[model samples]
Target chain A: GESVGLHLPTLSVQEGDNSIINCAYSNSASDYFIWYKQESGKGPQFIIDIRSNMDKRQGQRVTVLLNKTVKHLSLQIAATQPGDSAVYFCAENAGSQGNLIFGKGTKLSVKP
Target chain B: GAGVSQSPSNKVTEKGKDVELRCDPISGHTALYWYRQSLGQGLEFLIYFQGNSAPDKSGLPSDRFSAERTGGSVSTLTIQRTQQEDSAVYLCASSQVGGIQPQHFGDGTRLSIL
Candidate 1:
C-alpha cells in the first residue's frame, strides 16, 4: 500500500522564474531518493539525489530538499529554461534490493 | 564512455507474438534494471540484476514477462504472447553498484502490440 505520489500534475512557470515540484512518499524505510527529468522522447535522466541522512542536496541549478519528518521531498529549479521543460519524477529507493518506487511525474512547462 | 544502450528503438508486433528486448549496460557497471512506462505514466519497475546475484523479478507484471542477463552485462526482456496492454516503452538503466547509486538510462524501446 506504500506509494510515492506527487503533489502536482503540472507546473507552468516563466523562463526566468523558479519552479518547485513536490513529492510525498509513504515508505519511511526508504533511505535513498532521486529526481529524474524526462524529455518528450527520451528516457528519464538523472538530475539529483538525496539520502535520508541529509536534508538537502544541490546540483548545477537544482536543489532537492527532503523532510523526513513528513516523508516529503521537493525539487527546486532556478532560472528555469525552455530546455528544462520536461516531466520530473521523484523516486524512493525501497526494499533491500534498492528498487526504486517512482511517483507520477509532474510536467514542467517553462514559458519564455 | 557511453551510457546504457537499448536496441530497436521501436518494436511493432502482433498480439499473439513474442518479442525480445535488449539492453547493453555501461561497461564495468554491475547493476541493470528494466522498467515499463505507459503513456503519460510513471515508470514501473519490472526487474533488476546486480552482478552475479540472481535477478530480482518481483516487479514482473505477469508470467508472460521474463528477462535474463548474460555474463553480467547485456540483458534481454522477453514477453510471451504479448497483448495490447503490453504496449509501452521499456526502459533500461544501469549503475556502478545497486544500492542508492544514480542510474543512467537508455532511450528505451517503444513496443506497440497490434
Candidate 2:
C-alpha cells in the first residue's frame, strides 16, 4: 500500500539551531505536499506547502523541500525557537481527490 | 472570521455504546474532511465531503463508522457499538475547495471508549 512515513519519530534540537524533519512517500502520483505543526491537545495547523513543480517553498522561517525523484520531502525551520516545538507532519495529496495521506509525525523538542 | 468547529470537545463512553460527533465547517466552504488520530500516531483519513456530491467513504475503517454532510455545510460522524480500540481524537477540517488547498482544522473531539 502507498504510505507516507517519517525518518524520525522524535528530534531534540537546541534553540537558535536549524531543524530538519524528513519524510518519505511511496505515492509517485502525489503532486502536492504540505507540512503541518500540531501542538499538544490541538488540531494540525498548516505551516507550508510545496507543489511537485517546485523543489522548495518558503514561508516565514520555514521551508519545505520536495525531491520528487527520490520521493522524499523535508521541512526545515531556521532559528528554531521554543515556540516552534511541536509534532510536525508531512502530508501528500495524490491528486484532486482530497485524500491526504500523512506521515507519522516527528516530535520536535527545542531546548533553551 | 471563524474556523471549523466541532461539538462535544470530549466524549467518554463504555464499550458497545453508540456515539455521534458533529462538525461545523466554516461558512461558504464547500469541502469538509474527517480524520482520526491515535496517541502518538499520524492523522488517518476517515471520510471526505465535496459539495453535494456523494462522499468518498473509502477511508472509513469499518461498517461501524459512517458520516454524512447535509446541505453542503455541517457533517456528522456516527460510530456504532464502539469498542475500546475506537478511542482516539477525531478531527474535522474545512477548505475553500477540495484538493491541493490548505485546510483549516477544528480542535477535534477526543473520544475515549472504556
**Maximum-DockQ candidate:** 2
Error of 2 at A44 (Å): 0.2
lDDT value for model 2:
0.93
For all candidates in order, the CA lDDT equals: 0.93, 0.93
Q: Write the per-residue lDDT of candidate 2 for residues A1-112, one digit (tens) a residue.
A: 7799999999999999999999999999889999999999999999998889999899999999999999999999999999999999999985686678999899999999
Interface RMSD of each: 0.9, 0.9
Error of 1 at A40 (Å): 0.8
Candidate 1, A18-112: lDDT as tens digits: 99999999999899999999998899999999999999999999999999999999999999999999999999987767679999999999999
Per-residue CA lDDT of model 2 for B11-74, tens digit only, reads 9999999999999999999999999999999999998899866458888999999898889998
For model 1, fnat equals 0.71
lDDT of 1 at B3: 85
Any idea what lDDT model 1 has? 0.93
What TM-scores do the predictions have? 0.98, 0.97
TM-score of chain A of each: 0.98, 0.97
Give the residue spans of candidate 1 off by over 4 A.
none
Worst 10 residues of 1 chain B by lDDT: B50-59
